[model samples]
Structure formats: structure tokens, C-alpha cells
Target: MEKLIKIISNRAVLIVLLILIQLGVLFAIVFRFQNYFVYFYTFYLLISSAVIIKIINSRSNPAYKIAWIIPIMLIPIFGTVIYLVFGRVRFSNKEKMKMAMVQERERMANESTVAKTTIDDGNPNAIIQSNYLSKHGEASLFEHTTSEYYPLGEEAFKAMIEDLEKAEKYIFMEYFIVHEGEMWDTILEIMVRKAKEGVDVRFIYDDFGCLFTLPHGYDKKLRDQGIKCCVFNQFIPVLSPIFNNRNHRKITVIDGKVAYTGGINLADEYINRIERFGHWKDNSIKVEGEAAWGFSLLFLSMWDFVNSTESNIEEFIPEYAPGELPENDGYYQPYVDSPFDRETVGMNVYLNLINRATEYVYFTTPYLVIDNLLMEALCNAAKGGVDVRIITPHIPDKWYVHAVTKSNYAQLIEAGVKIYEYTPGFIHSKTCVVDGLYATVGTVNLDYRSLFLHFECGVWMYKTNGVDAVLQDHMEIEKLSQQISLEQAKNVSFPKKVVRACLSVFAPLL
Candidate 1:
């Protein structure tokens, strides 16, 4: 009874039930009016044609358009109605106004931190990529910054607590998941103490991501402890597609001088303290100096959005160095991506890295449901002998997603793109290292939702300790991962392969 009650009380279960009930009623109504079937059929055709046309014209992935088109063509009855409710990407008027405020504040913050970093004229590739992010993502490149890499979540947790312990002014954290466990408990203890000390401690977690992991009134508990807490896009029991827009970013900014980001979430499983998917593998970067300010601004942008309040963003900005600056630690540029933005910054960044790789490019992502453009880029890079490699999970968190991920492996392997699966367990790390010189570490996954629908963030680095650390971590992961050969991928059973292919069509939705 207790387990049943808990299952029914889950927000996801409730939302699913509500949507199913509404859909069932709609279907019943349509079936009841059988006498006007011809007219209904005509209306359905017209609506579906219009929706399909609109989807083709929208600024989205080709695979995504094809995915929707296939289903709409097959089930013309309910397809158009579904498309009308979920297909449109335009934000509601209220959401637009709020996002405008956040974007404008982000612009203000970006403007205040003009690019003071300079690169050698010989390193034109680095400068070009950095310029691209600066122009489109409103990010600044920093030169005099240092970075430390944690190849495992356990290492990052230790470093994070140390940083939190030393924070003098403020702390800001935004993450997709924040489950209650030994991990979050230890972090919360420090955060509560810091809040009582009058530090401006602020936290933001995605409501849907933590819906089952956290209690319904958990935000109030944090507030009672003097910590400012807000849930991003609080989950509502509705059938709107806007619920898909999740904040998938993981960020921590302390005193505006130290910051961290990567795949690790505030959950015990992430650190392998309480394993759910065997041994969990993840990575993170600890940055200091002016580069750290970039993450601070990123956090404040979302913070402003959640609180619906704007102040002098400059007041929260902290100088990485008050006196003399440290030695140059190469260039670092942090950027963000949102479904609201016209440009897909994360996708383009990956493309740029692949397109410009002179030697090799390696990446680690839990999911691999990519669009044609990224697939083409990887294949072309591999054909050009760029040594393209990718690491996906052996122990998947979602079976359907794993099936879809493996569906693309055959194509990639045939193109000479080497693929590996972490044999030990799941690897939730989202990282890419290119040419031993450039790398990125953050929450941007290789899937459609992370690339297109979600709000994500990542840090691009060139010739910095961050790049080396990420490269080293990837190499270590390679050692523990089992490589997938073209023959091995081709030997899958026909029935299983068919199911995987079918699942791939719905990859965007997954």
C-alpha cells in the first residue's frame, strides 16, 4: 500500500495519467461522431498538411522533422492535434517577457566583461572559435585563469566542499537534479551554515528532474534553513509541451572566483556512494580567475529568471584577482544554450571542434541521438583520418535511450569512427577533447534534447590545464571501455535491430 501510494503520488505518474485521460476523452469524442467521418477526415488531412509544412520550415533538426512527419503521416486522426499543442516552439507571451529580461540582463553582464584575453596570431583556430562564441553566445574569453580537473565525481565532491568551506561572500548553484542523500546532505549542511553566516547563498534545481527525488515541499525546508531556493519551471499537471524545456545545466559559483561544472549531479549515484547503475563515471572542471566569472554570470542569468527580479548584475560580479594577475593559463570561454535561442550554440560548438580538428577528437556522452549535420561531421572527420572517437555507457540509465544510442553505432563504425562502451557501468560525463589542445566540459549532451530543447551550458578551453585534464580523462575512460567494431555492430539480431531503428525515429521525443 505504501509503495502504491508513493507511485501514485509521483508527479510524473500524475501528469501521465492526466494527459492520458484527456487524450482518451478526445479519442472517444472523435469516434462518437462517426456519421461525419468524411468531413472529419478532410479536416484532419488539412490540419496535418499545415502542421507538417510548418515543421519543415521551422529552424530545427532534419531528423526531428522526419520523426514528427513519420508519425503524423501514419496516424492522421490525432496527429495534427498533437502537433498543434506540442510542435510550436514559440514561447508564451509571459515566458517571452521573462526570458527577454533574463537575456537582456545576460547581455549587460557580458558587456561588462569585455574580452581582455589575446591569443597568438599563429593560433588562429582558437581565436576563430572563441570569436564565434563571443559573437553568438555573449561569452568572453579569459587568458589568466587556472583550472583543475576531476576525472571522477568523488574527487569533485571533495573539491566542492573545500571551495564551499572557504567561500567568503556568496555561493550560487544551478543543477538539473538534486536528490536527498548522503551527497546532498553533506553539501546542504555547509550551505545552511553559509546561509546563516549571511552569505548570499542561492540555489536552483529543475522541478521535473527532482520531482521524485525530492519531497513536494523541499524548497520550503531549504528556505527554513536560511537558504534561498527556487524550482525552475515548477512542474504542473498539464499536457503542455513546454514542460520539455528543462534546465540541464550543472554549475557552482563560489565568491565569483571559483566555479565547477560537468555531468555530476547532487546525487549519491553520481559519486558512486550509492550505486544504482554499477560504478558511475563522470568528470568536472574547477576553474579560477577571470574565467570563473563567466560561470557566475551564467548562474545569475537563470537566478534572475527564477526570482523575476533584476538588479545591478555588476554588484554580484567578483574579480578573480584583486591585485596582480596570475600567469596565463591559456584561453577559456564559457557559453550557454537555450531552446528559446535561435542559434544552437552547443551543437555548433561541437561541429566547429570536429570540423577544425587537425589530429583527433574524442568525446564522452551518455546518449548519442544526433542529427544529420553532426553525424555527417563525425563521419567526414573520421574519413579524413582525424581519429574520431566516442564513449557511451555500457550500463544505461534508460533502456530505450540505450537502444536508440546503439542504433547509430553501425553507421559511425562503418565510417571509421571508433566507438567504445564503458564496460564497468554508466558514464554520465559530457566532455569532448580535440587535438590535445581544445576541449569542452559541461552539461551539453550529444542528444537532440540537450542540443535543441534544453537549457545547457559548457566551457570551451584551448591550451589550458582544462584541456589536458579532459584529454587525460578521456584516455583513461578509453582504457576501461570496450571498443565496438563495425562487424560487431552488424551482427545484431534482425528483430532487435528493427526495434532499435524504430526507436531512433522517435529519438527527438525521447
Candidate 2:
């Protein structure tokens, strides 16, 4: 009976049924008024034309504009409806007002965050990148902040559990996916016990991301256990473009002393307890000092927005014994990318790292769907004597996306860039290491969804332990991966090549 209820009440089923019914009714209307068909068709065509024009004139991604234009011109009747429901990635004016207010309050409170920290001006590349994040991304740069990188998901999980158990004041966690398994059960038990012990515990999960993984009204269930929970952007059964933007960030902050972020979600597969597509490979990082404060504020801002309440920034500040933190390192900066901000913080960071590379740049991403600008920068860097390498999943979780990933391989290989597919299994880590001096790790992928339509975060380190660790990990992982050459990319069957070419046209929407 429970299984039957799930099948009947599935959100996907309901959405499809509703859409089909609406489409049927519209067809009936058009058939009944056949005499005015020309007028109706003309009106929709004009609307579609206007939308296409607006898209071309707007400052959005070129690929996104071209993708939308194809459908509008090919299927003029229903294209406008589809575009209205998914193409517009903007919030209403009222939401913009509220966001402005939130930014203002946070900005005033963060004026002192990086006032004392300085990036060495000797590296003009590092200086410009740090300033861009501070002024545009509203993130601070910190010096002497300790960082630890985990090459495996299970390693990060074990370290995170240890940190969570030590929470004395508060625990904040925000993730894109939270499945009920050994991994989540273990963390949930810790959170439940900590909440009962008076530790302020909070969890924020994206509703759309957990649509099938979690039970309905899961937030209320957590709230009943004394854990403050917020369902980020509740998913209702409808066709709306606002729902396209997702909270893809995975973050955890323990009393502002320790924080974790990466591509690892709260699921058994991430930890490799169970296999879905062979061995699951991923990475995560732990910041254990003043830099953790940055992730804490990042979570609080999203929490405040969802709950409509401003939290006291001072209340969650880190309090530690004199000798608690590890000795200082080099510069560390944590920043976020959001659709609301309309700035591609993650993409720009990757571009800056690639363009400024004097020695080499390495990347690991599950998806390799990127725009022309990033592709050009990487090719240029490789051509100009800078080594460029990217590692992607050999065993794909999504075949279509993997095809799109392969579609760009020949061009990259032609320009001297090297590509590798992880032979072990899926490499679900979003990370970049450059020149053994700069590194970043978090949830930002090279794909369009992560770059333009999701909320994401990462830590950028310069000349720190993290940089060395990340570079070493990349080099080690490369040994386990198989290099894809230009011959392999271009020797595909004709039908496969045609499919990939078609898929590439809509890669941005993937």
C-alpha cells in the first residue's frame, strides 16, 4: 500500500498529467476556432520573435540565447510557452528589493572581515583575482587559515562526523541531496543528539534536489525533532522558470571552527558504501580556522532568506582556546555563485586561474559542458606553453551529458589540451589546481547549470598547503585515468557524431 501510494502520488506523474491535459484543452480551442487560426498563430509568432530578440540583446550566455532561438523558430506555437516557463532566469522586482536589503545588511556587517588580511601584491594575478571576489562576490580573503583536503568522500565523511560531534554552540548544514542511508543516518543521529543537548542545529536542503530521495515534508519531520530546518525553494507542481535555479551547494559548519564543502552529497554512494556506477570517486576540503567563518556566513545568508529572519552575526562567531587552531598558512578565500547575483563567480575564477597559469592548470569535473570563453582561455593557455589537463568521469551517470562532454574533445585536443577519463569510475569532484600555487574546491562544475543556474560555493587558496595537496591529488588521479586523444574523439560513428552535434547545440540547457 505504501508503494502504491508513492507511485500514484509521484510529483513527476502529476506534472506530466497536468501538462498533457492543458495541451489537450489548447488543441481543442484551436480546432474549434479554425477560422481565426491565422491570427492566433501570427500573435504567438510575434511574441516568440520578441522573446528571441530580447534574448539576443540581453547579457546572458551566448549558447543559452542560441539554444532558445532554435526552438522558438522551429516550434513557434509552443516555444513561447516553453521559454516563458524556463528561459527567464530572473526574479521579480520585489525579490530584487528584498535581496538588495539583505546584501546591504550583510555588507555593513562584513566591512571588517578582510580589513587586516592582505594578498601579496608581488603576484598581480593573485591580487586581481582576490580583489574581484572581495568587491564583486562579497567574500573576504584570509591569511593563516588552516586547510585540509580529502581525496576520498569517505575520508571527508569520517572527519566531518568527528567535527560534528564536537559542536558546542551550533551546527549548520546545507546540501543539494540528502538520502536516507547509512551515511545520512549516521549524521542525522549526531544532529538529533546535538539538538537535544542544546546545540542550535539547522539543516537546509533544496526541495527540488530531494524530490525523489526524501519523503514529503521532510523539513517538518526534522523540525519536530528540535532541528530548525528550511526547505530551500519549495517545489510546487507547476511549470515555472523560477524553479530552474537550484541550491547545489554542499556545506557544513560546526560552531564556526570547522567547515566542509565539495561535490560529495549525503548519500551512501558518495562514501562508496554501495555502488550505483562502480566505485564512486570524489573530493572534499575542511577549513579549520578563521576561514571557516566565511562558510558560516554563507550558510546563514541563505538561511535568513528562506526563513525571513536576520541572524545575529556575532552569535555564531567562532570561540576557541588560544592554542586550538593549527599554525597559519597562506591566503584563503571562500566565495559563492548565485543566479541572483548574475555574476559567474565560479566560471570567472576558473578562467582567471587558467589564463594566469605560468606552469600548468588541472581540473576535475563530472560534467565538462563549458562555454566558448572558457574553452578559448584554456586552449590559449595550452598553446602558449602552459600545460592544461582536465579529468572527467569515464563511467558516466548521464549518457547525454557525457556525449556533450565528448563533443568538445576534438577541438580541445587539437589545441594541445589533454583530456582524461577516470578509469576507476565516476570522478564527481569539482576542483581546479594551478601552477602548484593556486587551488579551489567546492560544488561548482564546468557545466552551464552549475555556472549560471545554481547556488554554489568554493574555497580559493594561494600558496597554501591546500594548493600543494590539490595539485598532488590531481597528479595522482591522472595516473589512474586514461588519456583521450584527438583520434579517439574524431573516429566516432557517423550517427553518434550527429547525435552529439545536436546535443551540443543545447549544451547550455543541459
Candidate 3:
């Protein structure tokens, strides 16, 4: 009965009702109001035609142009409407300019003498030299910063808590998901205490990411505790189509001296206390130095976006004197990517590292959704004899996404690319280690959402000694992962194959 009622109230039902109303009006006009009916019909036709043309012309991605063109030509109105709503690229120029201004200021600050003097001479191997970083206006090296890698969630949590406790000046945190669990409670306690002590503690969490995890008015609760809180893109129950755009970046900067970022969110699942899938394995990086200030600025920008609060940049700069580097060793450049920009900097950076890799390319991501450009680049690298290995999860999070992930296996596997799935639990780390010379760790997943729709940030390290630690962690994960063979992919069930094919159509949405 409920379903029947729902059917009667659908758009199709509304359209039928509209048609009946038009017929009634026409009859009335023919008998008593002929002039009004003709004008109405003419106006409706003109508006409908204009909408149809607008929709047809909006079908844009170059890859899908041909496929959508025929449909658009056939069902000019309906097809065009769908295309206009879902197709083409859209960005706000105003937001882009705002972001550009912030980034430019950051660049100028990075080039200052004070920024140079802050480099730690003791650590000379901390810099990465890459065309992608240089082209994007990122620093070629980061000085006065040190980094620590946490391979497991428990370790990362402990380290993060310690860092928070040691924070003297301020604390800035941005996370996608913050659940009501022991993990968050512990952090919240510390945050409240820190705020009470007059520490400028601020936090930004994505509304959609925590919609189900947190209850209503959670942000208010945090603010009442003295912790400045901002919920990114507050989720509205209705008329909120943009909920898909999330602040997927996980960053925490303390006193502009230390920072943490990686795949781990503030949830029990990440720490293995309340496992949802299986043993959850993740990774995080803790950094201390001038580079950490960059992350602080990144968090501040997002915080201001949500809270409308302006921050003094000078206050956040670490106190250090300017001088020549004691050694030409450690330089660190950190940058972030936003969907508001036309450039897919994170994706392009990954591609650049893969292409320029001389020895090996090791990557870990939960999803394997690839666009054509990335697929070709990886395959070409494999064909060029660069060892390419990727680690994905064995315990599927979203089955359909996993199926889509498997569907692309054959092409890569045949090209001599090695793929593995962690057998014990889900591997949520989004990291890449190339040629043992450069590494990246952050929240940018290897999928359409992270590649194009969401805001992301990652630490790109080149010639950094930290690459060895990342490589070691990757090796440890490989030991626990099972490698997939072409034979296994070929034997996938027919029905499952069809499901994958259908899901692939909406891969962009995923």
C-alpha cells in the first residue's frame, strides 16, 4: 500500500496530472477562453525548447562526448536534462580566486629569508626535487622539520595524543570523520583541556562524512567545551546535492611546529578497537618544522571558510633565524589540492612520479578506479620495465566498488603490474613510494572522488630519508597481502562481471 501511494505521487504521476490539466484548460479555451490557451501553449513550447538546447550542449567530458551525443540527439529533451545535471565540469571562479590569493601569499612567505633560516641543518636528506613540485610552486625542500611514520593505528593514536599534549601555542585539526568512540572521546578530552588552558584549539570536520557517526548539534557541543569547531559544508537534510564534496583531508598542526596527516580518522575502527571489516591497517606521518606551518595554514584556510574567522599568519610562523643551509640535504615542500581549481594537481603529481620512476613504483590505496590517462601512464611505465606494485584491500568495503576495482585488473596485470590485497583486514592507507627516492602520504585516494571532486592534501617527499621507512612499511604490508593472478580475474563469475560492467558506468559518481 505504501509503495502504491509512492508510485501515485512520483514525477510520472505529476506529469500525467499536468497533461490532464492542460487538456482541461484547452477545452475551456476552445469553449470560452481561446486566446489564453494558445498563448500558454506557445510559451511552454518556447521554454521547453530552450531547456532542451541548454541540456544537449552541456554534455562535455571528451571521453563521453560521442556516447552522450547520440542519446542527446534522439531524446533531445529528457536526455539533455540528464546531461546538463550530471555532465560537464563545473567550478566557482570566485572561490578559485580566493584560494589562489591564499596560495600566492603562502608561496611568497615560503620564499622569504626567515623561511630559509628555519631549515634544520642536521637533517639534510629531507628534500625532494621533482618537476611536478616545482611546476606547482611547491618548495623543493623543507627544512627544520622532522617526520615519523606510524604503520598501525594504535601507534599513530598514541603519537598524536602525545603531540597534542605537548602543544604549547595552538592546535588545528581537520578530519573527514570523527565518531563518538573512545578514540574521539580521548582526543576531545585533550582538546577541551587545551582550550581551557587558552590554547587556540580549532577543529574542522566534514558534515557529510560524520552525518551518521555524530549526532545533531555535535559542533555546538565541541564549541561549548571551549574548543573552536567548524563543520565543513554543513549537511542539510534537503536540497543539499553538494554533499558529495567532502573535506577528505586529515591534518593536525600543533603550535605550527608539528603536523600529522594520513588515512586514519578519529574512529575506533581505525585503531582496531572496534573492527567493522577486519583488522584495520592504516598509516600516518608526523612532521615537525617549517613544513608543518604549511599544514597549519592549510587547516586555517579551511577553518576560515567554515567559521568566517581570520587568522594572523605571522603568529603561526616558527621562530628561526635566516642563514645558509649547513648542508644541501633536507628540503620539504607540502601542498594541497582543491576541487575548485581546474588543475588536478594531486592526480598529476602521482602520474609524474609514476612516469619518472626509474626503479619501482609502490602504491597502497583501497580503491582502484582509474581514468584512461592514469591507466595508460601506469601501463606504459610497466612496459618500460619499471616495477609497479599496488596494494588494495581484500575485505571489500563497498562490494560494487571492489568489483569495479577488480575489472581493471586484467589490463594492468597483463602489462606486468603487480597487485595485492591485504588478507587480514582493510588497508586504508593512500601512499606511494617511487624509486626509493620520493614518497607521498595523505588522504587522496586512487578514485574519481579523490581525483576530481574532493579537497585533498599530501606530503610529497623527494630524496628524503623517510622514503626508506615508507618502503619498509610497504614491504611489511605486502607480506600480509595476497597477490592476484590473471587466472583468478578471468574466472570471475559471469553475473559478477555484469555487475562490474554496470557499476563501471557510474564510476565517476563513485
Per-prediction CA RMSD (Å)? 1.6, 1.6, 7.0
For residues 449-471, write the lDDT of model 3, one tens digit per residue.
Answer: 88877888888876565678899
Report the C-alpha lDDT of model 1 over 396-495, residue by residue, as the tens digit. 9999999999999999998999999999999999998998899999899999899999999989999888888888888889999999998888889999
What are the models' TM-scores?
0.96, 0.97, 0.83
- For all candidates, the clash counts are 0, 0, 12
Task: Residues 1-510, candidate 2: write the lDDT tens digits.
Answer: 999887878876666678667767765765566668788778777887788889999999999889888987887566666788778897888777776677666676677453557776588889998998887675888865798899999999999999999999999999999999999999999999999999999999998888878987899999999999999988875667887799999999999888999889999999999998777989999998888888888888888888878888888878768888667798888898878877889899998899899999999999999999989998999899899999999999999999999999999999999999999899999999998889999999999999989989999999899999998899899999999989998999999999999999999888
lDDT of 3: 0.76
lDDT of 1 at 472: 84
Q: Residue 407 lDDT in model 1?
A: 90
lDDT of 1 at 453: 90
Of 1 and 2, which scores higher on lDDT?
A: 2
Could you tell me the lDDT of residue 391 within candidate 2?
96
lDDT at 452 for candidate 1? 90
Better by lDDT, candidate 3 or 1:
1
**TM-score, model 3 to reference:** 0.83
